[model samples]
Each structure stands twice: as structure tokens, then as C-alpha cells.
Target: MKTQTTVRRSKYAPSVVTKNDLLELLNADFTRECRAIYAHAVYAERTRSRDEGAAARIARYGQETVLSALVLCELIYDYGGTVINNLDELNAVLNADRVADPGWAPETARRLHERAGQLRSAGEPGLAKRIRRIISAKKGAVPLAALVSGQQAVAGR
Candidate 1:
């Protein structure tokens, strides 16, 4: 017997999710969180004296990102997944440009968002939604895509 609820649930199920897929997704998420923590801490250091409130908010988001990463670590382990051991390798694999330019924090967020969209397209909407939350937390002070475009405009000026 078919029910509307069952059909809806079936539509939303992750048809393509696998241990390997989850491992890759979690690794990418882990890298994003690590970089976000660094970026926010650096932002706080760079602008703390000028804008204490903003710096505090950014630092708080960084802490939240740490928590998210911890949750992700648990999820990955539950799925029999392994995390990257070397931070440099993680950064290089995820965002070498971010390492070269810490100011590219917003771009990093955008990149994560895009990656999440890809996950969604690949039938991993749950993971995509989680990644979106991380992106939102990372972009605590400003909308990441808007911030990046604004910076580009200013640079062009």
C-alpha cells in the first residue's frame, strides 16, 4: 500500500550517500571549519581594537564552527570514516588560496556553499544542509557572497 508520507520520505532519502561519500564530505567540512577558525581568530586579532563587538561575534562563530567540526568528527567515526591527519595537507586539498590570503575568508565560505550545493545535487541534501549551516556560522558578520562581491567592487575602484 502506498502513502503520500512514504512517497515524500522516499523522495527525500539520500539515494547516493555512502561511506566513502560521507568520508569525503566530512573531510571537506572539517577543512572548512579549521580554516574558518583560523580566519575568524585572525580577523579578531586584526580588528579587535577597532571593533571589539564584531571581533567577539566572529570569535564566537569560530567557536561554534569548532563544535560543528566535533559533531562532524563523531558522525564520520560512526560511519567508519577517517579524518585527515595533516593540517597543511587538508588546507592544500581544500583551499590553498585561503592559506595564501587569509583575507579570503568570505570566498572560502562561498566555496563551501557551492560545494554543499554540489552535494545536494548528488542526493546528499542532509549533508548539504549541514554544510550550509557551517557557512552561515562562518559568515557571522556579513553575508559571505555579498561580502566577497563588495570587496571586489572596492578593489576595482
Candidate 2:
């Protein structure tokens, strides 16, 4: 009897993540860290599509907003800047956390906001509106559905 050889496939392949899968992954890290990463990634992707000038501006703003949020979260836990006062100190802590895993840089946050402003001023009101909606949603300032009404009101004027 002759034996046939079997072919083996590589174990690595791209995997798709559903909304629930992403939610589950969020549980793996602290909520603050998760939120920072999510915001940073969104900002990065948005800036990546812009021109150099626009990209730089958006990146700056994005970094600022995300860093601000992170700092706010820390303050909420540590009771109002009792521990850290400046971005440098905050960055030191963030850098350490990033070494163990991955995190956003302050610069990245700033650029995102700048790009967003550029988009708004460049007559891309629809895109700007979307960005504002995303920011508001991420910051929990308003509900996703309510964002539509808010945008409509602004656009109406």
C-alpha cells in the first residue's frame, strides 16, 4: 500500500472581529486605557487621509484631546491633580504603560484635533460634523442619535 503525503496550512490568518468581540477585548484592559487607544486610533486613521498641513493640525488636536481625557481620568481617580501636574509627568507614566503594552502619544492626539479644525474650515462641513459627532460620542457628552439633531441645528444656521 502507498501512503499519500498531507499538506499543512499555516496557522496564521487574518481574523475578523465583531462589535461584541471588540467589547470583550476592552475588558482585557482598564476602561481608561481602552478609551485612549480607541480615540487615538480613530484620530490616526482620520489624519492619515489628509494632506501634510491638514494632517499635522489634526494630529495635534487629536493628541491634545485624547491626552486631556486621559489626564482627566487619572485626576478623577487621584482626586484632582494631586499626583501629576504636567503633560511630561503624565507622559512618563503613559510611556511606562506603553512599554508593557501599546498606547497613544501626546503628539498624535494634538494632530487629530488640528486636522479636524482644518476640515471644518475648508468647507467640508459634513466631514467636520462627523468628526464632531465622533468626538462627542467618545467623550460621552451626547448620545449618538442626538448628535444628528445637534449637527442639523448647527448646519441650519
**Candidate 1 TM-score, C-alpha based:** 0.52
* Model 1: per-residue Cα lDDT over 1-157, one tens digit each: 8767674534334344555765786687676666656654665564477656655665665577567677666655655678863356444435533532545556666656665665676666776777777677655645322333444454466
Clashing pairs in 1: none
Worst lDDT run of 10 residues, candidate 1, spans: 143-152
Give the alpha-carbon lDDT of every model: 0.59, 0.39
After superposing all C-alphas onto the true structure, candidate 2 shows an RMSD in angstroms of 18.0
Model 1 residue 44 distance off true place after TM-score fit, in angstroms:
0.8
Candidate 1: clashing residue pairs, number: 0
155: Cα error in model 1, Å:
16
Q: What is the C-alpha RMSD of each candidate to the true structure, in Å?
A: 8.0, 18.0
